[model samples]
Target: MAGLTVAALGVVGFLGYQAAATAPDHPTQARPGSHASQSKEKDKDRGRQKKKSTALPAASGTGERVVYALDDKRVWLVGADGKATRTFEVGPSPASPDPGTYAVTSRNEGGVGSDGVQVEHVVVFHSEGGVVFGFSAAVDGSMPDPNARKRTGAVRESRADGSALWEFAEVGTKVVVIP
Candidate 1:
């Protein structure tokens, strides 16, 4: 009788071990209320806010027409009829020779020995065909020195497709547009 009892206990232990080892890794049943449902609710709230902010009025040409972006980083050519004709990305602003023109300089001083290298100075001629010219200058601000300025010959004619039509070296001061 004692031997039979011992045998029965050993069989029960082996069955428990086998069940644990062969069980699925994940839980068979999910919790009553999971975080997955809560996350979906939060996403819906964010979507509503985004929709409200981008709710622009219909193309009505009768209201006050303006050609500026909300962030002021980009300018749009809006007709008096309240229609946006063209849009251009305008970077930061600085002093310029031409009135209403602006200049923006993008520099990186973090890299090794990058203190002397200036990335690019984009001078945008807003009035004249909305021309945007790019130039690499020194960190000392010697090349595009707004003070002792010379018109770097049209580096290239501004194209609608953002391509350089022509390029001339650092020529004289005045940009002579040859027709």
Candidate 2:
């Protein structure tokens, strides 16, 4: 009986030693160069690449003219001296029915109202010396609403010095000048 008890005690002691040995130590704080740190570094690198890829180029020019191009659309702006000052994107007014002529007007009065009323008027303005230089698309359905009469695509404007004024969407489309 004594021998049997000794054997049982030995087995229990071994099990206890194993359980204590395998118990996890107090959770240690993560050290630098750990897996988490490596992952963070990788994320930062990806962010840097994304920013570089999406950066816009600086504009370039020195004359008084400005030319803008977005996709297949283009526009040219010239100063009184025939110098280009600014080029921008613009779409046709809604009153035009031709598909090959681009036109713009200073009057904006027609559009689909929020209440579903078909308000009919031109919207959008490009002014030079108080003169409206409106632009239009040469196709039907190009300008659907007066309130949203700006070009419906990307727009990039550059000054005569090649400095970019703005790069955005639907610019120079809404809001017209009368005189």
Candidate 3:
């Protein structure tokens, strides 16, 4: 009878170990009366907040300006209060401009883009070695691929974004480029 009892305990111990080894690393079973639906809703809300958040680094100078993050391929139209009024993604050029503060020197309502696309909202800010750096948007709302051979430094954005930039960044508007 004692031998039988030991054998039964051994069997139970082996089964318990097997069960634990096969279990998932995370919790697989839900607790009774747990708020699973509420947890899912909270997770979705967190995702939306994550999407809305853009952690902007410190920008140079003061007052209203447009901040372009070269590494992130993002742009933020900062207001005079140093708050971002608008933000969007952009297609960077292979020829990166030197990180510094610049002013919009010129504007064109429409032009034939370097990639031969009909573009609008051309805002020129910097020119070096014959490559004029600026922001533009295609008329068809398409972004052009950065052509290393062309030596153009036009940062392409969406049509709507370009329109906003065109209206916001006038001649002499501050543009801060950051690495």
Candidate 4:
């Protein structure tokens, strides 16, 4: 029943997105100066964009890189040929690095994360104001509570994704954060 509900919602959301994209707004009903309406429209557009788009970010530098998008909570592993080899969603970290390029500075095969979770494939990238940012997978295959009041900077991924990232992004690999 839960799966059915999710499938139904996905179908509904896709249909709504398609209708909005192709529908013509009536000129007589246009509220060109209505800030509220404009904001709502932009929100809807962002939702559609997140659902439908996974194209590598244009400004993310070429060559092999790990591209992390702050707003989307998604990461793309790009190859040297400038193609994304893998993309996946991540559990949001309490801390995020600024939008820029950095390199994978360190890594660990397995260890306990700052959040106190037993994790593996630890890939460290950036640090800011005492917060160390990296990607890892919880050994228990669990995700942290987004509402929790923790201050850890581990951007958690699924076990499979973590292993893939570990193999792809070794030390010195470029990591790009984009807003």
TM-score of each: 0.23, 0.21, 0.68, 0.72
Best by TM-score: 4
Which portions of model 2 show Cα errors greater than 4 Å?
1-71, 90-105, 109-179
- The runs of at least 3 residues in candidate 4 whose Cα sits more than 4 Å from the true structure, single-residue gaps closed, are 1-47
Superposed model 3: Cα runs more than 4 Å off: 1-53
Ranked candidates (lDDT, high to low): 4, 3, 2, 1
TM-score-wise, the better of 2 and 4 is 4
lDDT of 3: 0.85
Compose the digit string of candidate 4's lDDT tens values, residues 40-142.
6898999899886577878888899999998888899999999999999899767778899999999999999988899999999988877889999999987
lDDT of 3 by residue, 1-179 (tens): 99999999999999998888667663355464578556766879987865654665665557899888887788889889988889998987768799999999999999987777899999999999988899999888777566667667879999899999999999999999998
Ranking of all predicted structures according to TM-score, beginning with the best and ending with the worst: 4, 3, 1, 2
Question: What lDDT tens digits, residue by residue, belong to model 2 across residues 56-160?
Answer: 213413333333333223344544354544444443222322122222333432344222333333223343333333332221233234345442321212221
Please list the Cα RMSD from the true structure of every candidate, rounded to 1 decimal place. Answer: 17.3, 18.4, 12.4, 11.1
Estimate candidate 1's alpha-carbon lDDT, on a 0 to 1 scale.
Answer: 0.34
Q: What RMSD value applies to candidate 3?
A: 12.4
In model 3, which residue pairs have backbone atoms overlapping below 3 Å?
A: none
Worst 10 residues of 3 by lDDT: 24-33
User: What local lDDT score does residue 21 receive in model 3, on the 0 to 100 scale?
Assistant: 68
Window of ten residues with lowest summed lDDT in model 4 = 21-30
Could you tell me the C-alpha RMSD of candidate 4 in Å?
11.1
